[model samples]
Target: MNITIKGKVPPKAIIGVVILVIALALFLLKEPEKDDLIEISESDSIIDEKLEEGDLETTPVIQETIVVELAGEVNNPSVYILTKGSRVYEAIELAGGLTEEADTRNTNLAAILQDEMKIYIPSKEEVKAMEEQSGTKAGSDYIGGNTTANSSNQNKNSKVNLNTANSIQLQQLRGVGPSTAEKIIEYRNKHGRFNKIEDIMNVSGIGEKTFENLKNFITVE
Candidate 1:
């Protein structure tokens, strides 16, 4: 008997269509989920923000102003520029350390420094005299008997005027200390105006040597 042809497709074509459907189903299932992808991106964004904040905190900051001075027996005594909070040691190091002759024993390397302070390194004679004074050693002229010599020197120079002297004017003279300064003021109160610089000879304790020292450092006019 002859078989009638049916409307169904061929076996090879059916197989091909089935295979295509399976491939499409797999593609749809394997595609990334939008919510999952969004969650991952959100986690990455959080990490980025945290890292940014951390980086900001770790950044170094610089200070605007810093100044320091080194003086006294240093190879080169000078003021130096520094970053804020830099220590005295740093400045000393910059100046090439202390000279071989510098007396470092009395110096405090760790001392915090200020601007424009005079750091004096005393000479050997000066140091010895200071020590003698402190110990009150016999035969040491720690009381400064040199005042007599100073008096004699002052007498040789032009005289000073006590009554008319302004502090500015008075300080210009050598051998004038606070005590002498006060004396001049007192003399001014007792006496009227000074007739001339020569009138200073009348003041007690002033002499020729002191006047000579004052010559360069003072002015009569």
Candidate 2:
């Protein structure tokens, strides 16, 4: 159909059509960029959450502890806080170790310490005098050592000599039992002799309470 409807097209209608086409093109181009921005935001959020979780996992935990009271012959004798399973040697180190007059012969440095336990270190001269009074030869009757002895003779006063007392004589103390008596003798034999009645508490199992029960019946002489 060759219909010649000449004249010019409407300028307003052409301008409107062109504007609609440009707007459609802009929307199409911006859609992918909007989606990309959303994806980047989601990824950052995920990374932040993971970092927070990692921080929680890497936190440190504190260890359990025990309190022990140290006294006698140490440089600084006071109550000390120690980690559980700490040894007697460690406790001594915390208390500034043994002083010049400290006699550590009866101290079980390797023994694992208990909470509220007290340690007493005797003097060297005190131990020497006790050994002399007991007339105990240096190398005789060593517990778990080479020499052996006959049954110990009790003193006239009925006090057990911490230096020369055998297991049987040690058992005569008020609170001393078969095991504790053996421990006393072993301590005496291994470390020379008890310097004073208080030094008996330096043994592994003996504490302040045990010392109280046997103190009156025991003597270093």
Candidate 3:
């Protein structure tokens, strides 16, 4: 058959034009080349790997916190979460500090702190009882309980704060009994706080001999 537009067209020529159009359409709609498909797949795989690995190069905002527990003689005894590298005093301050009956003579207040550690502040009466049972003064200046294992002793070991020590704490000093501890307290109340450790001699009983024995163990706050 022949179709007329401007002139008559032969069947062979019409068939040739139709075949060319079909070939162009087939080429446009053909599946992508193997190389193109592989490139797309590789890009997607890279993105998935980055997502899975959490983009380690990009610094993630991670919070480094530590948990500590405080018990006995503090105003509030409980577990506390603190910033990493926090010390024992920070935990105590967070727990509202020591109570009136809290005995710190045998405690290492300057000790560094750690995670999952438990700090126990013994009571004065409990300390006295322990002393009585042991028949000697408790020599250990470490806090009683499960403390940090890997913490370095960075701070110098603390001595008793003379200006702040109570009667019981003062009695823990060498050559100071209950009566002498009271006398020291009385002197503090009348004349005011001791300016230095050497001033303890004014307490009526703490002479040069006693001061020599206890000087190494006491400190002013």
lDDT of 1 by residue, 38-123 (tens): 99999999999989787555556866655555555557777677665554566778766766655444334554444432333323
lDDT tens per residue, model 2, 13-114: 899999999999999987767788899999999999989887556557888897876766779988899998887789889999888997766446775655
Residue 80 of model 3, lDDT score:
94
TM-score of each: 0.36, 0.44, 0.36
Clashes in predicted model 1: 13
Tell me, by lDDT, which candidate is best. Answer: 3
Q: What is the TM-score (0 to 1) of candidate 1?
A: 0.36
Per residue, candidate 3 scores C-alpha lDDT tens digits across 133-193 of 3222332223322322211232333465555554555666668887887677556544555
Q: Where does model 2 exceed 4 Å of error?
A: 1-53, 57-62, 135-221
Task: Report the Cα lDDT for candidate 1.
Answer: 0.50
Choose the strongest candidate by TM-score: 2
Worst lDDT 10-window in candidate 2: 137-146
